[model samples]
Target chain A: MHPEPSRSLPEKAAPSLTGWGGSPAGPTTLLRPEKMRDFKPGESPQIARGMGRGYGDAAICGEGHTVLTERLDRMLSFDDETGVLRAEAGVSLADILTTFVPRGWFLPVTPGTKFCSLGGCLAADVHGKNHHVDGAFSQHVTSARIIPADGAERIISPDKNSDLFWATAGGMGLTGFITEVSLKLKKIETSWMAVKHTPTKDLDQTLDFLAIDDAENPYSVAWIDCLATGEKLGRSVVMNGRHAAIGEIPLRENNKLDGSFSKQKPMPFYLPSFVLNKFTVKAFNSLFNLRQGSRGEFVTKFDPYFYPLDGIKNWGRMYGKKGFVQHQCVLPHESARDGLRAILELVTESGRASFLAVLKKFGPEGRGMLSFPTGGYTLALDFANKPGLDEFHDRLDGIVLNAGGRVYLVKDSRMKADSLPYMYPRLDEFRKVLRQYDPSGKFASDLSRRLNIAGD
Target chain B: MPGIEGTALVLGATSPMARWTAYALARQGWDISLAGRDVQELRRIAADLILRTGATVSVREFQAEDLESHEGFWEDCVDQMEDLRCVVCAFGFMGSQDAQNEAPALAQQVMTINYTAAGTILMHAAKHFEEQKTGWIVGISSVAGERGRASNYVYGSAKAGFTQLLSGLRARLSKSGVSVLTVKPGFVDTAMTFGKDGVFLVADPKDVGGQIVEAMTKRKDVVYIPGFWRLIMFIIRSVPEKVFKKMKF
Candidate 1:
C-alpha cells in the first residue's frame, strides 16, 4: 500500500503558510508581512523571499524565520505611454494582467502560470512564449531594491551593481532580498490573440511541423499524446499565435477584461482514485483528438485557447492525495526526438498517467544563465504520484542528462543532485555571484540544496 | 445475492482505513477487487485477504492523475467486480504544509492529490454506481473540514469542499438507489496522524473502519467516526468569529 505521510503541528498555535498553491502546513510562530518596511531580517525574519513558486523547496524556510509577501502586493508606478512599470516585488502577474493587459501593453515575459510575484519572476529570471523574441524577465528588468546579506539596502541593476544584478536575476532569492522592481513592458495593439491551430497525426509529424514552423511563428507550441506509440507516438495539435491587430479585435463588453474574465468553477474534492484509469484516459484522448479536428482559420479570444486552465481556480486539486510532479525539459534540437521519446516511453511503459503534456519550440538563450529555454524543443508532462514514483523520476532524470537537457526548475520536484551541472554549464559562474552576496550561505532553500544550486 | 455477493470494488483499497473497511466487509462474504496505485502492495494485501476471508480477489494499478488510463483500468476491473456493491475512498494527503507553503509546485501537488484527483475518480465512480443502481460510496472526511483552521487548513479546506460535494451527491443520488456516505473522522490513529502529538481522544483505524461499515449497511446520511466528534465539531463551528479569531485552535 502507498503510505500517506503525515505530521503533527504545535498545538494552540496559529499556522501561517504561504505558497502559490496556498497549501497548509503545521503551526509555526511565523508571520507574513505585506509591507517592505515591516520586514526586518534581523528582527522579525532571518531571511526574506518573494512569491514562493520554487517547485521542490527553495523558497521554504526550514524551521527558521520566514517572511511571506502576499500582502506586500502594490503597483507603485506605471508609465502607460512608455509601457514602463515599477511595482513592489510582491505584485503578481495575474494582478498586472487584470490591471494592464487591455491597455495596449503586456508583460515582457511570463511563465506557464501567471500567479507569480514580480520579485519571484526576477528571482527566477522567468521566460515565456516570447522567450525567443524578448528573452528572460531579467532582460526587461531595469533596476531593483535589494537587501543584501550584510543587512544593507541598495538599488542594484546591470549598470550599477552588475555583479549582484546577474546573480540576483535567477539567484533563487539567495543573493539578497528584492523589495521592489522597475521593468519595461511590451506594447500590444489589442487584447485578442491571432492564433492558428494545426493537428498532427503522430510524434514524428508533430516534430517536423515544429521544425518547419519554428522560423514562421514567434510563439509555437504542440500538445502531444504520450500514450500513443509507434506510428502515432507524437501525434499532436500545434497552436501558433501572435497578438491580434486592432481591427481583428472581437467585439465584447469591457474589452480590457479580455475574453478570459469568466471564472470556471473548481472541482471541489479528490475523485475516487479509480476514475483516471487507462480506459478513461484513452476515451478522453480519442474524444479530444476527434473534437480538435480541422476547423479552418478561427477568430478566437485569447483566454480559452491560451489560458484554459486559468479559468478554473484551484484546478490542481484534481490530482488527489499523492500530488503530481510536472516534468518539463528542454533538449537541444539535435536530440529533441530521442530525448522526448525516451521520457514518454518510460512513463507509458511504467503505466504512469499524465493528463496534460505540453511541447513547445524554444528560441535563443535568455538573461538568466540557468534559465530553461535555449533554442530547443521543450516537453512538459504532469505525472501523478503513485508507487515507484521516485524511481520513475530517477529514470527520467537519467534520460534528461543523457540528452544534455535539463528539467525546468519551476516545474521540477524530483531531479537527482548530479543532474544540475549537466543541465546548466554556467553553474560555477552563477555560484560565484551568489557567494559574493550571501557568503555565509544564510539564505538557502530545499530546492537549492536538492539541485545543489547554492554552494556551501 | 444480498448486498452484492459477486465482488465489491474498493477504489482506494491501499489506504489504512480503506483496507480495514474492505476487510470488515469482505469477511462478511463479499469477493473483493482491491485497486490503488501500488498493485504489488495490493497483491501482498490480497494474499492476506484470501487467507482470512477465502474470497476471490484481484489487484489493479489505478492513478487518479493518469486521466488517460482510467477507461482501461475500469474495463480490467469491471468483470472482477461484476455487480459491484460498494466503493470506499480513503486516499488523501496532508503533505508537510511546511513543504507546500515553501513551494507553489508542492502546494499544487497537495491540492491536486487531495481534491482534484480524488474528485475526478469519485465522480466517475458515482456515474457507474448510478447506472448500477445498487452500489454504495463511502469517503473519509475530517472534522478539521467543518471550519478552516490555521493548522492544516489547506488540507482541512480541501476536505470541507469534499464533504460538501459528497453531501450534494448523496442528495442527488437518493432517488437512484445509490448511497453516497461521507465519513468524517476526527483524530483517527493511523499513519496519516503519525507526527501530531496531544491529539485529544483519537479513535483507532479499526474502529473507524467498523463504523464506516456499519454506516454503509444502515445507509446513514453522514457519520462521525466516533460520533462525539460531530457534537465537538458542532461546538467548534458555533464559536463566534470575533472570539474564534482571537483564540487559536
Candidate 2:
C-alpha cells in the first residue's frame, strides 16, 4: 500500500489572544488544524476556540494550547428530507444560514450573533429569543464527535454515553475538544420575519408583554432602557417575530427566499473610553427606544431580526480597547421582578450607563446540567471596563445570589468561585463527569479556572 | 451568468485552495470531479459542494506522487466527465527549509511532487485538451518561483520548473484553441501557511479562487492573486543576483 501521508503536526503559533470582551487577554499557544483528520489532542490543559466570539474567557486557555477550530469548518453532509445537518464544530452559524436559508432551512435556535461556532454554542448551551418556546442550542443537537485528553475520539449523544453527553452539552469545552456535531435544522417558508414591536412604560408591563403566549410568534426579545429610573424603570420595546409565510411577503420583492442582508462598514477603530459615558449612553438609549418602538408591525429579513449587531463587523471594538464585561443572569419566575428591579436600580444609582440592556423569558430547564436557561427571566447588561467596575459587578452578583439567580458563565468575565455551587446545584455532577473523562484536568480555561468548575 | 456547460476536474481537491476553487467553479454551475488521495475526505467535500451549490459532483482517487498512475487517473476523470473542459492543478509540498536541508529524501520528494509528478499529469491533460481544441488549464505556481529566496529555494525551484512547463504548454497550445493560465499566489492563508512566521499580505483562498475563475473566463495568460503581488514580485525580480545572494529575506 502507498505509504500513508505523513501526519505533519498541525501548525502552532504563540499569540496574545482575547475573548470578544477584549479584556483578560493572555499569551497562549494556538494550534490550528485545517482538516478533521488533523485534529488531535496535542497538549494538556487545552481548549477549542471558534471565532473567539465568546464574550469572556470561556475559549481562552492562558499559557496553554488553544486549538483554533476555525479552519476545520466544513459541512460534511445535509439530509434535505429530514433537515438534519452534520457539520464540523467550527462551522459558523452565518455560513450555515447562507447555505440553507435559501433552501428553506434554518437553525432551530441561534444566539444574537450568527458569528458563533457550533461548538461554542454547545459549550455555552446558548439560548435564543425562542428559548421560551423551544430551548437551548443543545436540545437540538443529535450527536457530537469529541476528542478528550486521551486522544481517543468518542461519539456522544443523548441515547449513548448519556452522562458524558449531558456534561459536554454546556460543559464549556472543559470535557473535551468537540470536533464535529450533528443538529436538526428548522424549516422556514420564507427568509423574512413578521415582527411586532410593543413599547412598555415600565418593567412590569415589559415582563407582562414578554410572558404573553403568542402562539404564532416563536421568538421574542426586549431591548431595555437601563438608564431610565423611577417611573420608567425598565422601559423596553419588546420585539416578537416568527418566520413569515410566503403569502405574507410582498410579491413585488424579488428573490423572496434570499436570506442575505447588507453588512455595515466595520468600526474603523476603538473609540475613546470617554465616548460611552452616561450622557452619551442615555442619549443613544433614548434614540434607540424611539426608533425601534415606532416600528410597530412589519416584515423584515431574518438577519436584522435575529442578528442585528452582526451587521457591523467587530462591533465589540466600539466598547474601546479596555473592552467591556457583559453581566447576564437568570432569575427564576418567583424572584425575576424583584431581582431585575434591584439590578436596574443599582445600575441607575451607580450611573454606569450600560450601552446595551436586554431581557428574555426562558421556559423549562434544559437537559444540560450547566446550561444558563431555566424557567426564568434572563437580563443581560454590558458595562465598560473602568475603575470600580469589578466592585460594581460584585454588588450585582450579590444581588443575584440573594434573589437565587445564577450568572451566565459564557457572558461572565468575573464571578466569585465560591458562588458557583449555589448558582448551579448540579456543579458537583458536572465535575464528577469531568473527573471520569479527563481525570487529570487536561482541559481548562480562564473562566473555568476563575470559577473553579474543574478543581485545581 | 452560467459557466460554460462542462465539468472541471480539480486535482489535489482536499487542499484548502483547491477546495475553495472547486466551490467557486460549482457556484458558477459547473459540474465537478474532485480528485485527490483521500477519497473519504473528497466525498465529504463533494457532499458539501452539492449541499451548498446543488452541483453534480464526483470524487476520484489521485495520488500526486504516484507518477505511473496519473495517466490512468486522467483517463478515469475523462470517463467520468465526457464534457470536461478544465483542469486545475493545486497540490504541492512545502517542507520546512531546515528539514529539506538536512534530509535529501525530503528535498527530493518536494521536487518530485511539485514538479515532476505535476508536469506528468498536466501533459496528459494538455494532450486531451489539444485534441478537444477548447479547454482551460490552470496551474497554481507560486510567487516564490519568480525569484528564489534562500529561505525557500528548494520549493521555489520546483515551482519555477512547473511554471516553465506551463509556459511551454501555453505557447504550444496557443493555436490549438487551448488556454493556459499560471497563477502566482503570494502568502495564502491556507493550511500550508496557517502559523508560519513573517507571512504578510496573505490573500484569502476564497478570493483567490474567485479570481482564478474570473481569470479563466477572461482567458488571461498570467495573473497574480490580489493584483498587488505583481508589483511585489517585480521589485524582487529586479534585484541583482550579486546583492540578493547575501541579502536575507
Q: Across the candidates, what are chain A's individual TM-scores?
A: 0.89, 0.97
Regions more than 4 Å wrong, model 2:
A1-6, B1-3
| lDDT score for residue B245 of model 2 | 93
Tens digits of per-residue lDDT for model 1, A1-456 = 223433232222335443333333323343454235544344322344455555544566555555566545556566767777777777788777766775667777777667688888888787776666666789899898888767788788889888788778877777777887888888877777777778899777888877774544566678777777777887887877777776776676667336245567777786655667555776777676666646534656655655667677666666665556778888888888898888878867887777778887777776566666777888888766667888988898888888888888766666877888888888888889767766766666546766778755
Q: Write the per-residue lDDT of candidate 2 for residues B61-100, one digit (tens) a residue.
A: 8998989888888888888789999999998987778877
Highest TM-score: which candidate?
A: 2
Clashing pairs in 2: none
Model 2 accuracy (lDDT, Cα)? 0.89
Name the TM-score of chain A in model 2: 0.97
Instruction: Give the local distance difference test score of model 1.
Output: 0.71
Candidate 2, DockQ to 2 decimals? 0.55
Tens digit per residue, CA lDDT, model 1, B23-103: 778777877888887675576457546544557777877785566676676666665556676777777777766676776
